[model samples]
Target: MIDLESGYILRPVNPVFIYFSLFCALLLNLLPIGNYGWVPDWLIVCIIFWNIHQHRYIGVTWAFIFGLLMDVHNSDLLGLHAFSYALVAYIAIAWQKRIVALSVASQALHLLPIFLLVALFPLLMHWILSGEIIWWALTGAIQAFIEALLWPLATRILLAPQRRPIDVDHTRPL
Candidate 1:
């Protein structure tokens, strides 16, 4: 009996906030710690969040650009991150209406597969290139789980600025 309906009525999101959040996420992803298996891709998380919540402002193009930046930062295969990011963005946008209506936990469950795909891309690419499947690459599943766990928190924080005050007073029109 999970509730698909969201309780809050959010105001229009500010374009500036979206950009600032994306910038912060990119900076976070650039941190050296991000390369570790324990750290989920912050940029990808933000990109998916925006794609699901604010499709008009953020889309596949943004994901591709950020992915390219990450590729350069990691010096990994060119377009690897870009392609995965674009794929994630496209999926999120495609499911935007259904996802937005779900409870945060439900949304996380729905997003798990997309995150897994993104996490496994590197391992998949490596296997394709070297003709060897690395069992250690399963650790990427941990990162995918972490990303899924982060969805509720991300939804809470990112939507805070736009949420209408709980205690609506006559003094406030909005």
Candidate 2:
């Protein structure tokens, strides 16, 4: 079983953790499910975590790439998720300092709008490109709510301390 708190690997700052998280996000995205009332946006959750903690390593480019992968996997318009994810990444990076400092509860509150924007962007794009408004707007809204609810838990998991043994010096000559 992978450690949900410390991620799948032992190395704290390893790029592999990011890659693993992204891969898991993609897997979660592709999980087969018949039309659901609300499906949590797993990729966005993962993206937010990495962007908040590893902004220097994972930025807009990484978001774009993973978003494009999502596009290919889901067989949606090529640039739809790509653009939305990149925009979210940009926003997250722009607010990284504030986000990093926020309490988990506050971060969840902040994530509500971010997830709403993520949901809205795709719906708006689909309407514009297909010239048909999807009736699932309500469903998407609910999914955004679910995503927001999941944010604090996800953040706590992602930000958990990596060191297994807290080092302390117990020996001294007095």
Candidate 3:
């Protein structure tokens, strides 16, 4: 019984959806696209989806937790992904209104630069930590391409069900 337009909650947040999103994001992150780096950033895609749909609640904390989990799962330098993801989550929340309102195609187009930055974050972190610029140019390009291509489809999938109205009866009392 949530109002999509106003984002007013008539009931508690759907825990099922929340946890499902989290699990899906984690799985997406774990998918073995390869160590080469052409794989799309599926977790970030999910993060953007939740951040756009549930901005008020899915802020930096969730990002931090997910980022930490990603660090552990990928066995990367701790806090690097977490820091970048937290920043991205914060940005997504800040722009949720504008983002959610845009057409899916537009959203995909907008994600181009954002995904580029996301791709760069890890590379930048590695450089800072190890002082070596990993030559991931090809992988970064491919990832950006995949992310841009998948944005519209992912947004549609996440938002389609939520767009439907749920039945409510004013005569009923909790």
For lDDT, the strongest prediction is 1
Which regions of candidate 3 are displaced past 4 Å?
1-13, 165-174
TM-score of 2: 0.83
Using all chains and alpha carbons, the TM-scores for the candidates as numbered come to 0.90, 0.83, 0.80
Give the higher-TM-score candidate: 1 or 2: 1
Report the C-alpha lDDT of model 1 over 83-149, residue by residue, as the tens digit: 9999999999999888977788889999999999999998899899999998887888999999999
TM-score, cand. 1 vs. native: 0.90
Per-residue lDDT tens digits for candidate 2, residues 1-174, read 223333344336668767887788878888997436488879988997788778878899989998898788778889888898999999988887887666777888887888888788877988888899888665777888898888877765664554333454568321
Please, what are the lDDT tens digits per residue for candidate 3 over residues 1-174? 344434644444575776687788788778877655567878888887778777656778888898899889879889978988898888878877776667777777776777777778888878888898888544776787788899878765665555554776677542
Of candidates 3 and 1, the better by TM-score: 1
Q: Global lDDT of each model?
A: 0.87, 0.77, 0.75
What clash pairs does model 3 have? none
* Residue 58 displacement (Å), model 1: 0.5
Ranking the candidates on lDDT from highest down gives: 1, 2, 3
Off by over 4 Å in 2: 1-12, 35-37, 161-163, 166-174
How many pairs of residues collide in model 1? 0
Candidate 1 stretches greater than 4 Å from native: 1-6, 164-174
